[model samples]
Every structure is written in structure tokens, then in C-alpha cells.
Target chain A: MSDQTYVTSDPRGSITQLATPSRLEYFFTAGTSLSKNLRGYQRGQFIGQRCPVCSKVYVPSRGSCPVDGVALTEEVELKNTGTVTTFCVVNVPFAGQSIKIPYIAGQILLDGANLSFMGLIQECELEEVRMGMRVEAVWVDKEDLVPSLASVKYFRPTGEPDAAYETYQEYL
Target chain B: MSESPEIFTSPHVLEFPYSRSTGPVIGSFLTALRDGVLIGIKGTGGKVIFPPTEYDPDTAEETSGIVNVGPGAVVTSWGWVNQPLKQHPLQHPFAWALIQPDGADTAMLHVVDAGSESAMATGMRVTAIFRPADERIGAMADLIAFVPEEAK
Candidate 1:
């Protein structure tokens, strides 16, 4: 890969620079902030926080209530079933995307939880996965499970009727 | 809350693409490495900087001149990596060392491909091992790995 043939400018002393392509990596400490939510996965529990002011619950809570701006202290257990508040059919290839193309993924508002969390909608046709579709968590083998959302492989159709739009209208 | 998970972790891959002109000083040193030569620049106080920098790290002034130094040098300090990682330069037991090239006051960080931990030591003489010319493309990677002068 010499530049012998590709001479640029007059050859007295033309100083050209070189490009060094490289990568940098770092690890983020989950710390105490997101510890409780992660631990819940180990026991197959959907742990969340309840806002004392608004009574809204956040699944896998981040430190505070979004609307109230107050620290959340009350823990709540959310049901496995939830409504798909929104969704998209992914058909594009991307880095770190492990799922096959044309799969359904969306934000599911778990039962009794106010915040919507994202997960893949599986065990149904792509067209069958719609907004407000009822879905339940599909757990991976318990023996191989860890304290992470990955423990729930994906969300699958619950074979239940879609809730009336009015039930999730506030979320829209 | 009273119920808290002990620890949480997720895999995240980060990539950084640094695109810039090395200008004259750095460009020269790297070009020298491609030509099977090692170079440094004369910085303030008669000290030489290996893998030459555009400016003196301490004084932040433009460096003075280029000096040809060490194809040979002594290891000043090192850490042994017993369990080799895939991303590491060597896939075997090796030492990550800071070797001060002859005639240079400061040390440069690199790997030494000594067969065992017992084979490495401070003040051990080592030299740059450049990749074959046709295989080199003017990069720090061109200098494959340092080995004990005896091994060379």
C-alpha cells in the first residue's frame, strides 16, 4: 500500500498527514440508581415505583417521578400483561440489532404501571401486533436468567381482547 | 426503596473515529517508522520525546528538532497481563511496558512479546520490531511488538 504511483503535487517536500482509525470503550456503573429494578428480573418480578403525588407507577423506575419531580419511594409490582401504547415494524439492519428483520417492537404500558417500556412483540404475525394489543412477558429459562430485562426474552400476545382506546387515550 | 438489586450491568460498545492531520512533526516520526527507523523530537531542556509530539507536554511550546534514537531501549516500568484478552495486542502472556528509548528521557507505552513473565524485567534491553515493509501502512501498528534484545 505504497504511494509510489499516486504522486501528489511537486515532490520537493510535501508533508501530508495520515489517518489513524481507532475505537474507545467505557463501562457505565449501574450503581444504586437502577439497582432495585435490575434485581427484580432475577425473581421474575416487575418492580416499579409509585408517585405519591400523582399515584402514577414507573416500571423499572429511574430515581424520580417524571411528572411530580419528586423522589419515588413506594415500590409496586406490575402484572405481566400490558397494552401496546405504540409500535413499529423494524425492517432495517443495524449494528447491535440481534432480531431478524420485520419484527415488532414497541412501548408496552404494563398493567398497573404508568410508564411505558419497550420490548419486542413476538408469537404473532407482524400485522397482528397493533397498538393497544394485549401482550405478556415471555421469560427465558429461569436457570440462565440474570437480574436484567433480558431475562424476559420478549413480549408475546396474551390472546386477550384489545382494550378500548379510551383506556389508553391519556397515554397517546 | 428497601428492595434494591445488588448490581446491574449492560453491554455497551463504543467507537471513536479520530480524523485529523498529524501535521509535520508527528507525520515525520510515523513516516520514519514506515521506513524501518525510529525517531524522536528534541523538546525543552534537551529532553527527547519518543513517538514525537507536536508540542512539549510540559512547556506547551513547539518542539525544536527531530533526533534519530533507539532502535534499542530499556524498560522503565511494566505490568504483566497473564490472561490475554482478544482485544489485546498479544494473544499470550505479555507485559504492557513503558520503555525509554536510548537518548530519550521519557517512556512510551507498548507491549513486549516475552514468552513468560520471568523473561521480563525493568532495565531489560528491548528494540522495536517493525512489520515487513510491504505489510506496513504508516501506523503505530507497523511496529509489531518489542522483544528482549537477546530474543531479537
Candidate 2:
């Protein structure tokens, strides 16, 4: 876009400001643990890794457990189902926001994964979103799957009974 | 896990995507660049800073005013990029240099298209080459690159 320039009048003096259009392009490599998780996504699976020390699984692991500081050695295939442990409704509009306003940006604790990851929660009324709400991954068409988390378009309410608060309270 | 996952690599762009107020000193400097001219602000001890900041780097004193500096410059220091990256200004190899333009006391960062690594050297005279007038905008990229000043 053409840069927009403006003259601002203030009590002190008028200042000239320009809207500087900028872009930074670079390559991003999904290293080890994330690579595994994304590879699973391409095959219609949710893969997590288990921390040997704490036995806790990390989805989209950072190649190691954050708390235990040890390599996550065991590979665990998790269900697409998950729980909305926490969320906030984005009602305010700002620059560079891709999703529409009033949508839920939730922390989803995938089944069998000890930790949660942020994902867009959709396909339900905004007021219906809540902690302990059961949700499921809504993936793109099977053939459209790729080695990226974007393969799953968003998470949606699963119509199952809400996971008990105690079941995911530790995650919050 | 028995089998290691294949490493996945993809291009990612982290962007600020917002307009920032350049204020007085920087605003004038960028405006000069868009006009195909170079300017510097007078600092403490009468030193001129190209790509001027609101405050003098050395004394932290407010700069006085803008002065026309250079279409000519000197390479104070430089490093060669043997293989240029995609984001680099020049698609091919070039020397990233700290160049002090003529009439400016402080050095500004820019690239020198000296054609080959052997041709680049500290204290080498160079000249700023601005992009076509129509392509000019109030940004650093307005000056496409510096080239070796023709031997006098």
C-alpha cells in the first residue's frame, strides 16, 4: 500500500508523520519436536511427546519438557478432541488481525496432552464458549493436509459433555 | 521415537505493519532522501550526523539543524557477503559498509556495489546512486546502493 502521510497539529507544534509500509520476509524452520507434530498433522493425527522425567506429554513440544528440562522421548498419538481451558473474546479491532471480531481465541488442552496450545475456537455462539467446554479439531479437507498446524482450520464445540473443571484446572 | 521426523522449513514473515511517527529530525532527513539529496544534522562539536537522529550519538545533546551532505561517501569499514540472502537489498554479492558521506561527520550504514570483493577496501571513495525519481520514497532504500567513485 502507498504510505499515508499526515500533518498533526498539536499545542507545541505541527509534526509531519508518515505511515511507513514495511515487511520482513524470512524462512521459519519447525525444528525437531514441532516437525514431528506437524508431520503427524499431515497424516491426520495429533502427535505429542512425553517427558521422561515427569511423564507429562507436550503437544507441539519444544523438543524437550520445559519444567523437567529433559528430552521428550515417548511419542504419543492424541485424539483430535480437546478442552477449552481458557479463552478471551476478541471484540476490539486492530491492525493485522486475520480473524473477525467477537471470535474466541482459546487455550485448547488436547486430549492426552498435558499442556495446551492457543487455537481459534469457532462454529459456536460467542456466548457459549467457556472453560471446560469440550472441543474438537476441525481439519481441512483430507487431501489438503500439509505439514503445518494450519491443516486444522480451527477448533469447534464437540457436543460432548463439558470436561469437568477438575480434569483441566491444572492446565489453566 | 524410533524414526526421526523430517525437518520442516517454510518462509515466515514477522512484520510490524504499522506507521510510526518520524518526528522532526528524522522526518526532514527522510524527506531530503526522497528528493534525491542527502542531509545531516549538526551535533555537539559541530559534527554532522547523516541519517540524523533527534539526539547526537556522542554527547546525547539535541542536534541543531539539517545540512546537505553527500552524493559522495567513503567506506569506513566493510564486510563482504559471499552469498546474498533473499531479503538482501542487492540480489548478488555486495559489501555491507559503514560509509561516511562527504560533508557528514558520522557514518551511516549502506551497501557498496563494488562489483567484486577484491575491489572493496576501507577508505575507498564511493558515490550514492539514488533510485529513479519516480521510484523515490522517503525511506533509506531510496538510495539504491553506492558504487566506487570513478578514479579522478
- Please list all clashing residue pairs in model 1, or write none if there are none: A36-B5
* Clashes (N, CA, C under 3 Å) per candidate: 1, 0
lDDT of model 2 at residue B44?
A: 84
lDDT of 1 by residue, B57-77 (tens): 999877777777888989999
For each candidate, report its DockQ versus the true two-chain complex: 0.22, 0.34
The RMSD (Cα, Å) of candidate 1 is: 8.1
Worst 10 residues of 1 chain A by lDDT: A1-10
- B31 Cα displacement, candidate 2 (Å): 1.5
The sequence of per-residue lDDT tens digits that candidate 2 reaches over residues B1-152 is 12334777777777775788887777776677777788887888888788777788888887776678888999999999999988799999999999999999889889999889999999999999998877876777888999999932
Which candidate leads in lDDT?
A: 2
- Per-candidate TM equals 0.58, 0.74
Q: Locate the minimum summed-lDDT window of 10 residues in model 2 chain A.
A: A1-10
Q: Top DockQ: which candidate number?
A: 2
- A1-172 per-residue lDDT for model 1 (tens digits): 1111112232333235666557656555565536777787878888888999999988878878878899988888888889999999999998667898989888888989887888988889988888889999998898967778888999998889998788776775
Give the poorly placed runs of model 2, Cα more than 4 Å off. Answer: A1-33, A51-54, A67-70, B1-5, B44-61, B72-88, B91-102, B105-127, B146-152
